[model samples]
Target: MSSLSTEHKLPEIIIPEDYNYLAFFISLNCNLKCHYCINLNDKNSARKDMAKHHMDGSDWAKAINRLNIGRDDLPVTLQGGEPTLHKDFYRIVNETDDSIKLDLLTNMAFDPEVFIRNVPVKKFTREAKYAAIRVSYHPGYNDIDELIKKTLRMADAGFYVGIYSVLVPENKEHIDDVMARCKGLGIDFRVKEYLGFDGEKWHGEYKYMDAISQHERKSCLCKTTELIAGPTGHVFRCHSDLYANRTPIGHILDPDFRIEQIFRPCDWYGFCNPCDIKVKTNRFQIFGHTSVEIKDIHELN
Candidate 1:
């Protein structure tokens, strides 16, 4: 991975207003293996671990700092199976320029003392609809009391933190209980609509129902507002490509790599990831937004 030259620099790539999110999937190696992880994607086996192929913190910073996010409201979200699992997680957080606002998605499984010492309070603080550090609470894998303690610890340290759980059908009652407990403890708890199949029927609201049909394969012109960066600095067109380890649209560290805000032709319409096609809330918590805008669903034959 190479960095751009300071003397002959390419024009700064500005994040468009329509671009809802920028995700840096630092690593996919999670400490807790939840059964209903979306990364599985109906696959019979687990995807190959790419932790060894990840880019260095400095390299990540060099590439990410090039982006011109002109909005005060939008922040680049750092997430993964567990972003804290990355060895250079702190370094990457520290190295990113102060101009870039960061939001973290973690399971709160990491040592809070180490994180508090390394990451500045201001780095995660901003005027937003939700907390900066959003921790996921997986029922069986994560203990509610422990998560609350950790979140409160971070919050007491002057860092904004919150807890979110998926409303899986089986865990619906449990999630509600957890949310009530969190609210009682003064924690900003939120719930996300689960987005996968449940044996008989598929869950979630999607812009294109056929995108995840698993039966139909069609060619379409697709465009994404969100920039999805994988562990090894590879920028993917969609979440499916990122998780499947398919060919990326570009590499972040590559000086030649630049974000194109226009639509590109795609042939994997029906095989799309649930996250990409799922109709969900935006940064402002407004509903009726999908990550990718797909059109021209044509038959392969």
Candidate 2:
């Protein structure tokens, strides 16, 4: 792990005026291993070994604080195999600029009392349809009862919290039961569309079928509206590249880093991650939006 000096002022990374999402994978390490983990969805073996250097909380704050988001609707999302697993998770959140809103995606594996004591509620508070602190409830991997207790505890403490779960085909029955229970308790419970294969058929609503087909590699020009940074502060073209540990477009700590909105060349089009190509809701809950766009696709010889 590395830390940034407080005296150094890194160059501003101006987020494109049209950019929709900004994500920082603080640490890819997690406490649970779900069978349907999206980070390991790639056909390649690169994701199996995700042992990479991570930026400490101070450095992460320094790198993130350099961003000029210029929008109130979009918050800097802190996610990971589990973001709370980062040693300085609280420090990173508290040290970030007050002007920047923050969002957290986690599995709720931490102590809620410790979180409430360390985190400021205002930092994660925002006017949105969903909660700012979004917790994923993996049916078999995590306990829904414990999650409900933690969520209610946080909510009572003035934090906006919501619970989400993927609608895995086999787990649908249990998920539905949990959703009803949560709704009865006045907790925000939502279901996400299951992506990837389910033993027999491919699942998910994707714009480009061939992108997630995993059949053959193809050449194409890809562009993204999201600013995705890995644990090492390296910005990737898309989630597919981020999880696969592929080459990065630039490092966040680089003094000259800037957001470039253009179509870049790609050779692994068929092995795309579902999060990039899935037809899902945008920040405004508008449907039919995809994170990355691919064009000029052709068979690779």
Candidate 3:
């Protein structure tokens, strides 16, 4: 992990009233090279930028601690190609303020013993619709038996954990079997709808029809309910902007930065990322929620 200069004062940033979710992309490098990864589905995806900039655990703590997350329903989600890939994974989790709950999305490739010893079970506990530590099961990169063993071990240790798999066309046949086995083992297994194109057709249900069309590009005002933080503490207005390495709206570590709820004009509406426009379940596990809100969807004159 790289150290940031500490000479400057940090800001006491407040969470926006309308903010619904926090996603921290701690690192984009993953152990498993899953072919269906939505993060790598586009030309603008930041696969090359992963190694460029990443903050030390202390810096992450200082910036994230400033956030006043007031709702029990909202949590600062630690995610990445694999968040645990960060060198200070344990320190980051331990250092974040306890008042703000945490959620993690990971692949079960890590040592459970290390995780059990470092992460307190209570830090991840919150009143929510789904598990706090979400484990993504990639059939080709991982085995069901091994993943089950890991999941069971964590659950036995009193952690809020669950297994989820993307329902790709090729994997649809195996999902039911996997779900049944998970149910038999007393695990909370879920099937996630695939979000990208499958060579034949696009998979997910989206709020905007042309927003994700690859060939079309348009201008619009886009607002997001998500507060997205990249590895180096840069905040972005949308997923497309983040992955493309476009100039960030602000940096969390900057003393002057604050969350703004108003919509901002965008020139790449039709080329929006699927993750932002896709219709999916929210923190409450309620369906019919999209990450962003787009208005004035029309071609630039």
Candidate 4:
């Protein structure tokens, strides 16, 4: 993570009009290691290795501030193994342009008092059906009692916070109970569908069935509408490429960098990440949207 040279100003990167999501993986190192973590969906051990080469806060702010995300509805999301784990997390949040709102996806492993003191509440404040700061509730790993206390403290301080947990089959009963308890305590808690395997079968709804089959690698042309940046400031075509540490589509710090909406050749179609191919909701809260569009699919001999 070298900072961009101060001698030259980087060109402004314009976000595509059709882009639905923009995320900066400030750090991929998490305090909690959930068994069903989606970042390891590719089953690659090197996924977390990039955490060491993460661009410092100033570099991240420089790269991010170059973006022209004209729409207020789509905020640049800061997420990772746990975004709060980044050493310069607060600086990155405070340095980003005021025109660009931010959303945080975290595990709530940090002290709320320090977070409230340093970060401005308005940076994450926005109008959305869900809270801007979304916390993941991992049963058995992150204690529910502590999470409840932190959520209450942040909420009382005027920050919109919400807790979410996946509906894994084994934890379904427990999650249901927790959801009820959170709602009763005035916490906005929601249950998300589990998107990985359970040894017996796959548990998610995907647009391309073979993408997550893990049977055989195929060739296809894929185009993505999401802007996913890795810790090293490399922009990837999709989440699969980002987690696998594959050759990036481009670097965010590149002076000539801009969004390319065309489909590119990909040989790892069968090994596509579930997040990219999953039939999920768009920013409008409308269903029936997939992150990447794949075409010209065939087996690679």
Candidate 5:
């Protein structure tokens, strides 16, 4: 498949307090198949991956245009199984306005030469807690030396990039070993807490662990604190869309769609995906954000 580059120059401005942070998964297809792929987990638990579909690049670009975000705040985060794997990857990034402040989450498997020759480093950066481009180091799927070389090359090209590794049980020792090597190379390699099972018991920090086990039938009103989209343009209220492949709250291209930051009714409390209902912090470095909030949903009409 040929890659597409979308180009649009946007003006610089401050982020508005009301603009919601946006995250878009341009494609669900990934180059490296990790054993602990969160998406693949959907196939067994939520039935999401078994019947997943993806939107074209043009559709994604149009979906992004409908969003009203600010330059200083969160621009649309373009991530995926591997975003560069998208046929129109570059086009989607370039076509967006300059004010959008593009951020990319990838495995850095693409040709840096193509990235340098085409994409400007300045396009993906802003004054934020993390770098613009966040790359992942999967011992299961990535070679440390090559990953380091690509990262350093990008940094040399003047891109604000960082590396994060998941602390999978089998790979914990390797992760630490890699972090030591990367630290010496002057690369920022951070370890993220793993949140899935290893065929024994589930892991990670969760507010209500019981909700995920399918232990019993309980009902409550829920609400989302973030914007999450599936491989397709469908926007779901929680990680359940990622796992269950349920109907989306709305499509990213819908102009009338907006975020409602409060609890509402939900009957699927028993099937909650950990990513959504888990307690976490937002862009502002503040805590108390849950992807979905529940309130007296059992009593709903």
Candidate 6:
């Protein structure tokens, strides 16, 4: 079927009533594994087994290509365990239409020369104030000095690069030290509030703690403004669905697929992923947007 005809046949993906940002997981395959990674929040081995497989680079590029993100808001975000790890990373980046504003989440572990040789500055940048290239700083796996150097090199190459480190309980002081060092070196460094459990306890900044605890469930209406694509073409409602290997709502390649902005019922309210359940601000920096919602949950045993 022709692209235009397919689009016409497909239900127009209605952006949620107050949709703001779209986050696409180019691949869940990351090189550096943080101990406190939220992806492991749902420890159900059975659920993890059900996760979707990775999609091909061409298909990924094609799927992302169909998105209709408007100006200033930025287009789909290309992220993963490490998007650069994908065999067709460069191709996907270069293949995407020029109109879409691209953002990257990386570990900055790739060869800068390769990045500089093939990708232009405009490919991964926008007029937005925040740096486009968000490099995660895992103190355990990455060297801060090297991170600073690499980011500086990217900055020098005209890439809007920055560093983001999760504030894990054990590494707060080290993180502070790294922040000071990066600041002195003129590299963009920021911290993400840690999310998930670490054996003895739970940590994060959410009021609806039990909503995600899984020990108890409270149903509430949930909707998402972000577009989450697993390694495969399967699109998920929120991080929980993606990480828990829940079935996807639709695939970009399928002509029948279109985004729905409605609050769909989710039975696994207790299994919410921190990324989705967390009450964080939206793209416009407005607070109070929960990706998933439950209408009627039982608190009884």
Q: Looking at candidate 2, what is the lDDT of residue 250?
A: 83
Q: How far is 94's C-alpha from truth in model 2 (Å)?
A: 0.9
User: Comparing candidate 3 with candidate 6, which one achieves the higher lDDT?
Assistant: 3
What candidate 2 gets wrong by more than 4 Å, as runs, is 1-7, 41-45
List, residue by residue over 162-268, the lDDT tens digit for candidate 5: 89988888888888888898889888888776777677898777776767776666777676656777666677777666556676786655544566665665667
Per-residue error for 116 in candidate 4, Å, reads 0.5
Per-residue lDDT of model 6, residues 1-301, tens digit only:
1132333333334444455566767666666667677774345664445333466666666666676664556556788667887788888888887877888888887988899998999998777756878999988888877888788888999998989999998999999998998888888788988888778777776745777676765555666767777766667888777776686887767766787767776667777888776777666557777655545566543
Q: What is the alpha-carbon lDDT for the whole of candidate 6? A: 0.73
* Tens digit of per-residue lDDT, candidate 4, span 77-124: 999978888999999999998888899999998999999999888999
TM-scores of the candidates are 0.94, 0.96, 0.94, 0.97, 0.85, 0.87
Winner on TM-score (2 vs 5): 2
> What's the true lDDT of residue 29 in model 1?
74
Best by TM-score: 4
Clash count per candidate: 0, 0, 0, 0, 15, 7
- Give candidate 6 regions above 4 Å deviation: 1-17, 41-52, 217-221, 299-301
Query: Each model's C-alpha lDDT?
Result: 0.84, 0.89, 0.84, 0.89, 0.71, 0.73
- Lowest summed lDDT window (length 10), candidate 4: 40-49
Tens-place lDDT per residue, model 2, 1-301, is 5433446788788888778899998888888888898775445566545534678888899988999888889999999989999889999999999899999999998999999999888999988888899999998889988999999999999999999999998898888888899989999999999998877888999999889887899999999999999988888999989888898998888787798889999999998999999999999898989998899999886
Question: Candidates sorted by TM-score, descending order?
Answer: 4, 2, 3, 1, 6, 5
lDDT tens per residue, model 1, 101-159: 99999998798988999999988989988998999988898888898988889989999
Assess the local accuracy of residue 54 in candidate 2 as a C-alpha lDDT between 0 and 100.
Answer: 78
In model 3, the runs with Cα more than 4 Å from the true position are 1-9, 41-46
